[model samples]
Target chain A: MSEFEALDFYLMDELLSDEQRLIRDTVRQFVTEKCLPIIEEHQAAGTFPTDLIGPVAELGMLGANLPEEYGCAGLESSTYGIMMQELERGDSGLRSFVSVQGALCMYPIFEFGSEEQRREWLPRMASGEVIGCFGLTEPDAGSDPGAMRTTAVKDGDDWIINGVKMWITNGTMAKIAIIWAQTDDGIRGFVVPTDLPGFQAIEVKGKYSLRASDTAELVLEDVCVPGDALLPKSGGLRSPLMCLNQARYGIAWGGIGAAQACFDEALRYAKARITFGKPVAQTQLVQELLTEIASEITKAQTLCWRLGELKDAGRARPEQISMAKRNNIEMARNTARRCREILGGNGILDEYQAFRHMVNLESVYTYEGTHQIHTLIVGNALTGLPAFG
Target chain B: MRIAVCMKAVVDSQARIELDGDGNLRQDQLRFEVNEYDLYAVEEAIRLAESDEGHVTVISAGTADAVQGLRKGLAMGAADAIHVDCDPDDLDASGVAAVLAAALHDGGYDLVLAGVESDDLGGSQVGVLLAEALGYASTTLVVGTNEPVDGAMQVRRELEGGEHANVQVQFPAVLTIQSGINEPRYPSLKGIMAAKRKDLAVKGLADLGFDGAPARRVESLGLTIPPPRELARMLEGGAEETAAELVRILREEEKAL
Candidate 1:
């Protein structure tokens, strides 16, 4: 509630160029007032917040982290992270929708699509008229996307795609999908509409994590994409990997939001919950748990602040991101465990949200390259030997 | 219309306030800032300037340290600034108004804007006396504003019990903007650097043909701390019990709600 207090810990905002704090605060207020109030109910109901799309667009969070000429907010990378942090502070699933819409969809198009491609799609995405999802992970080749068997063939003016993508966020509701397939050129990303023939998205149904988001299986069978729909500059596995990097940067900061929430809920509960005629907050064990939670939160916040700096300065590397994403989410998961113990019987119940975080991190822990995969990536960087097979 | 604004340098709201020997807030060592309410007025003047493409000069009468406050106005897009080194202790609403009016008398400005009150001082008589002394139409504590038209400005002034009055003033006018009139924008980083090169005219009391300042000593400064008293018993009970205890204590001892 007090931005001035947050500024003291994460002065990441101070490193911005101009008008960045204003943009950060505007999105912060929106999250605090609008998102936080109804997020729990929506998350519990396991439904995507469709009403949020227009407001998110109005705040320029839809197609943020892009050039201004293409109807984007064109904010600095730190500003984008601040927006993601505020949005995820409400719910990670809600912020994930924007990440998919902006970074996963608009970014590859703006970076690789021809001029006509930019004109046709960016403005609509900016205005929230269109929602999109990325199709890259398969039922088998999630962590190692290069092993995917999806294929696209050149046929006249159209390209035929045949593939299946699993665990696609916003898959069921999206109007378009940035589908990555093995083409003759190499592994490439494509813009495929949901309305195309032989393209279908089936709701994955009971999901233990990110339930509020529309997780689905995106299936393509001879789905004809116009030749121009193929991303012009995106070739090899690096193109789709770059999109993952953008999403991971947001996720790196988002983990702190989840950790902070768990810590705050447990802190409040510990102060109020009484056992043996004394507040649990006064117990040495509970205090120790809280102290650990606070330290991790503060350190992760400091790390992410620098991470945002590296991103804004154009020096952010995948291995550098591998460290934060792996460290912070595990830290968050541990904090969630401490919170669950503090709440005792109340923790498992829906009223406390500690268990939800614990379960959510299990999926978040594995998605966007599994935690072990990231550890290996970092280890490989340290030893100067690629350990990942 | 060319307009001038006079602002005060107060300590930042978030800064911890301590009572000085004078039994007032000790401002030393704290980051001094422009009054929060005045920020909305500055933003309004900027809005006027943007639409009308007119000149706005901000003036503040304090020591050289107060130039920081004036530079804040410049960074908010003021045309220029003026800082007059008037002693903070010697200032009253009317006397400061006289100093300001003397500084801007021949500037050919059509309007003047100021905050209704400063957080440090409860008095809100400056804009009225400034307009009166300069023979300009005056309105105080404006809560809302309408688009400028026909060489006049229309403002909504609060009355007793949540009532409001729509008042219009001709070209030469003064209006004290109420707090929460608008949200002031953060000065762009570029604006702060740009403000450093902006010309800030500093004038002395003699420069205005003013022999000296007006009357003071309405209040005297003293150095004594209040004696500490024993702590009251804080009730720790259910909401209903706490509410009943509060009501009983209010009725029996305070004798008024």
Candidate 2:
């Protein structure tokens, strides 16, 4: 593959600090040199690239935006978003792993866990000696996590969790799982060690979307954890929703990456592949598709940059994040389809990235609050009314 | 074993090459990175310093943009950095050598390392010239080095056509490193963060007491891209006819009969 030409139509690079640009470039190099080579093979084999975890951790990608005191990079929100963009440029599955690790798993611990929990886990997790997964979505609770059937019952200063979590990313290999369950008080998060008795993570197999990632059905049959394992500050569905906000912000940026990857593949193919004695890129129809994709990508980049700035300022609302996630993922989905169309017959092949991203964006479109869920969230914010039944 | 590594900032390999009407590079349009060869020199220095428990300092002579390259060195675990504040356009290779020598003269470095050549210029003269200016023993195309023993270090050099030579250079020496001496590591996030806190002292020519404008003993005669080569002709014939044609051309066109 040719080197990724960063699509900075608005010259967004000028807005980034030197450190932020360096971080983004470092991750970009890692993607080009490490991830792109093996990702297709892994996706074909339906296996995760486990070897990259060590390198990714050494780069401090996990929990990158957290505080340096707990062994993180302490980067700004925008830098973290940039990291996601570059990582997803390689593959959405790869970005999903980091998002699950940083935003879903490690973030809750830092935000709501006890200080001892943060001290014990964050450093090891930062170094990649330990891996983590988040378990919130269930067979029944896809969008409304408040309706989750998982229960955490009090038993002699230990919580006995009994339930199943579906679509858990990084589940099988995680050393620990951050499980959000319904308690007597409300929906709460628990830091459950995967090695504990009655805890099992069965790999969800034969997945077409996100094939390079490890998804699993995590079952907790009366799993017991100490009282300290509870995330002290977490309460109600809002806590888990906050975690989703973090991951969604990353996905908002990640959508652009997937779109850009497909766009790059299609552009290269259009310029090189000859039809009717002329390059397809020279044709008006092909040019139109390329232009539309580029324009959408530029708009998405602008949106994400402003969103990141707002997040760093602590002024970004959940509905605003919903707008970004919804708009960018839908934009990416449309771009991927058009790019795939531009590739014509070759679009179906895994050798080309268009179809691969086309399928992957489908999963991205649904997960982390589906397109419909976000639309309502934003709609509600605008109308001052609850439309979600 | 306090070591100093000399770095050079060159145009990034991926940046589009645009020459001015005068046949010089459009400097403002280019993005500069640490010279590829200099990474090997920096890596070797860091490795030696790590094993021998010494400090490594990186120094470079270029414009303000050169600090970005120096920061890369620091991120690769160099103990500190020294930036010789001067426009590279103002200096030839000799002037660069003089600036580096002036910076390192008072630092009392036990060894100095530099790349065999800059990626853009490919002059391969800076290290040797710096050695001469500082009155230190020097070796070029050094591929490997052993630990210092009895005030000298064993070094391996690559000669022409895969031949190798081993020599022992005394302390306070300069070694121009070749590529493949070692695989340079990506700067870890921890290293990148720590580099920000590392000491980076920028010195000017006046501060180094070389107050006069540098004399360019060898000046550049501009640069131009070589003309594109003609495409090769394809043979349009059966295997037997093509083979016969190739032999005929070899005998007649080349006069090789």
Candidate 3:
């Protein structure tokens, strides 16, 4: 197998520290040697490779950007972004597991939970001894989570949560779910243990995309927990939105990984696959496709790296993240499609990664705030007007 | 105990090596990595250090690029690194050994480890020469090492034709390691972070009390790709006829039945 060389047309490596480069190279090697070998089989069977959790955690990838006080790696944001890029290069499914565990689940607890809550969950989750999922989207509230009907009613010292969550990544496999519900004050976050009496997580079946990931629907029929389960600092929809921003930031970098994977596979196939009288790589049209994809990947990489720097500096804006999430995912989707075309009939085969990445990009394009939602966010930022009604 | 691992940076064997018009390697295009056998040596040093509460210091002789290999060794749990700032191409085996011996001479290390041979040169002379320079007893083709018993280290040496011998050497000895001693672990993230904080001392030939000139130099004569082997012949006929032809070739043409 040809090694996946990350496109660094902008010399982005010059901006990274030695530690960051080491982390990136280590994770890239891990993904190339470990994840890529079994990803296809898992995707074919539509099963998540649970055996990888230990190895992934051993790399300190779970909550890697978080502080080391709670057993995390405490790496810089750019290093975290590079790790996401490498993981997604192997498979979007693998990256999704990390994104859900780190950005959506662990991050919220670290950012908004009480000291006791943080002390209880962060270390175990970081070690992959316990898996977690974020539950915000509902059956009727896909794009507009404010319309979620999940309710948390006070029953003495306990809050009884009642509702259903949809399209939850890692829902079926998680040991805990960070559920967002409407309380008397506003929407609040609650940590609901999956083993609770009234909580149920059923695996969603027949997903054509992101086949190697575990997506599920969570049902809470009066799931009761002590008042301590509520994230004391979380109030209103902004809390979940903050978590989505973290995940979306990772998605921006991850989109480039998928694009790089497709581009690398297509480039290899073009040189080896012969048509007519010569290799297809010699054809002008094929070369144009390669050039365009390479150009877009470089641009996307620059955007993600700059955003990572801004994030590390605590100067990044959510709208800027929206722009990157929107632009990079679109670029990756388009690149995957073009790379698929470049591979011709062989593109549809599972042996080639372009088709698999092309399909996975569809889910990545839609999740963590859809492409349309992100476009509106950027549009609202650019023009001083609210476009969403 | 303190262990010193002598490492070398060599071009990746799988990389495409190109020769320039002057018959010199196109070094700019080739990807250089830590010598494969040398990695086993480094791993063994780290293992020995970890179990004995000792320290491992990796030393490499090359230009600034050789620091990459040293950093990799550090990331794999070495305590520290020393970069001998000299272009590897400017020295022969003895000259390289001289530089290494100089760096190791005053370090007060109990043991010195090196690969049996580097992947690029395949010259199995450096360890023996380094032993001669440092006045230390030496063993080559070492497959394993036992804990020190009675101030002496017991090492298993792989002999020719699948044979092995156990030899014991006193402290301050040089051992050249063969590959497959153990599976080298990838650098963990914590180890990588720790490596960033560890000291990487850069030393020059003058610091080692030697002039920049080498005692011996190696000059390449030429380079060529080995000739491809002949393709196998295919016999075409009925199964019985093909089988008969095969038997005839093995019995008559080969003079064996």
Candidate 4:
């Protein structure tokens, strides 16, 4: 693949600070040198690239937006968003790994876990020495996490957790699982060590989308953990939903990366591919497809930059995040499809990335509070009416 | 051990180069990075100075904006940096060497390292000129170096035609590093955060006891891109005719008979 020409139609690069651009370029180089070369083989084999964990950790990518006191990079939220943009520009699987590790796993521990817990796990997780998976979505609960049946009951000084978390990224590789389960008071989070006797992680096979990522089913049969395992600050379903908001923010920017990747590949291919005695790029229909993809990417990029700004100011609402997630992901899904069309038959081949990103965007569209769920969340915010009922 | 690595800030290799109407490089859109070859010198200096009581300082003479390049060296584990504030374009290779030599003369450095040549100008003169000014022995195209023993170091110099010569040099020697001498590491996040706190002292021409004008022994006339060559012509017709045509073209047009 050719080097990605950043499709910044709006010249958004000028708005970023020097440090932010430096971090973004660093990650872009890392993905190009380390990830892009081997991702296709891993994607074809349906295996995650485990070797990248060290390099990623060495870059302080895991929990990068968290505080430096906890061994994170302590970067601005916009920088974190840009990092996700560059990571997903290579592949969604690579972005998913960082998202789960940083936003979902490390965020909760920093926000809800006790200082002891944070002291115990955050540093190791930041170094990639200890991998973690967030267990919130259940087999029965997809859009509605409140409907989850997983429960953590008090037994003496310990808590016994029993439930099955489905479609958990980094599940099989995690040494600790941030399992959210129902308690007598409400839904609370437990930093459950995977080595507990009744806990088991089974790799979910046959996944066509996100093939380069690990998805597993985590089964807990009376998994017992000490009292310190429970995140005392966690109150209800709102706690896990907050972590989703963080991850969703990153995915909002990530959507732009995937779309840009497809656009770059498609545009390059169209310029070189000849049809009807001229390059396909000269055709009116091909130009229209390219225009549509570029326009959508620009809109999504501007939206993500604004969202990142709002998040850094701490004024961002969940509904605002919902809007970005819903809009950008849908835009990416459409962009990937159009880019794939422009590639013609070669799009299906592994040598090309459009089809791969197109398939991966399908999974992205469904996860992190599905496209429909975010639609209702935005709709409810606008109309002042509950539509989920 | 105290070591100094001479680094230069050049235009990023991947960025498009555009010249102005005055035949000078358009500076507005250019992004500057540490010169590619200097990264090897910086890496080697850092590796050799890993023990306690060992320090590596990166020094560069360029415009104030070159601080970004110096900061990169700091992020790569340099203890500190010295930036000679001036436009590099205003100085030729001799002038450039004078500025660096003035900055490093009394710094008590045991070893001074630099790249064999810069990417943009390819002068390949700064290292030797700097050594002459500082009154130190100099060698170029250094591929490998062993630890200092009894105040002298053994180094392998790349020779022409796949040969290398090992030589011994005393303390305070200058070595112009080759690119493949070592692989430069990307700045870790920890190193980057720590770089903000590291010392990067800026020196004016007067601070180095000069009257703000370096000795410009050479000047650039102009720069132009060479004309593009004609596209290759394919021979027509089958074996015998094309062979005869190739011979005729080579003998008559190309004058290679």
| Best candidate according to TM-score | 2
Candidate 1 overall Cα lDDT vs. reference? 0.81
Q: Which of the predicted structures, 1 or 2, would earn the higher DockQ when compared with the native?
A: 2
Residues B1-257 of candidate 3: C-alpha lDDT, one tens digit per residue: 89999999888776788888777788777867788888899999999988889999999999876887888899898999999999877788999999999999999988999999999879998999999999999999999999887768999999998799999999889999999998887787767877888999998999989877476656658666657888887999999999999999999998888
Q: Write the per-residue lDDT of candidate 2 for residues A12-104, one digit (tens) a residue.
A: 888976566667777888999999888889989999999999999988899988889989988788888998998899999999999999999
Whole-model lDDT per candidate: 0.81, 0.91, 0.90, 0.91
Locate the minimum summed-lDDT window of 10 residues in model 2 chain A.
Answer: A16-25
Model 1 TM-score, 2 decimals: 0.77
lDDT per residue (tens digit) for residues A1-389 in model 4: 54678788888988976567667777888888999899999999999999999999999899999999999988888989999999999899999999999999999999998899899999999999999999999999999899999999999999999999999999999999999999999999999999999999999998989999989999999999999999989999999999999999999999999998899989999999999999999999999999888999999998988988999999899999999999999999999899889999888899988888899999999999999999999999999998994
List candidate 4 segments past 4 Å from native.
B18-29, B233-257
**Worst lDDT 10-window in candidate 1 chain A:** A1-10
Per-residue CA lDDT of candidate 1, range A1-389, in tens?
A: 22222323444444654345445555656766677677667778888878878778865687787876787767667767767776766677887898888888998898878899899999899888888999999988977899999999999989999989999999998899999999888898889999999999999988777767889999899999888888899989999888888988888877877776677788878988889999999999989988888888878888888888899899999999999999988887898888899999889987766877787778778888899999998999999998887
Candidate 3 lDDT, tens digit per residue, A1-389?
A: 75777666777777877677777878888998899999999999999989999989988899888888888888778788888988999999999999999999999999999999999999999999999999999999988999999999999999999999999999998999999999999999999899999999999999999999999999999899999999999999999999999999998999999998898889888999899989999999999999999999999988998899899899999999999999999999999999999989989999989888989999999999999999899999999797975
**The 10-residue segment with the lowest total lDDT in model 4 chain B:** B185-194
TM-score of chain A of each: 0.94, 0.98, 0.99, 0.99
Rank all candidate structures by their TM-score, best first, as comma-separated numbers.
2, 4, 3, 1
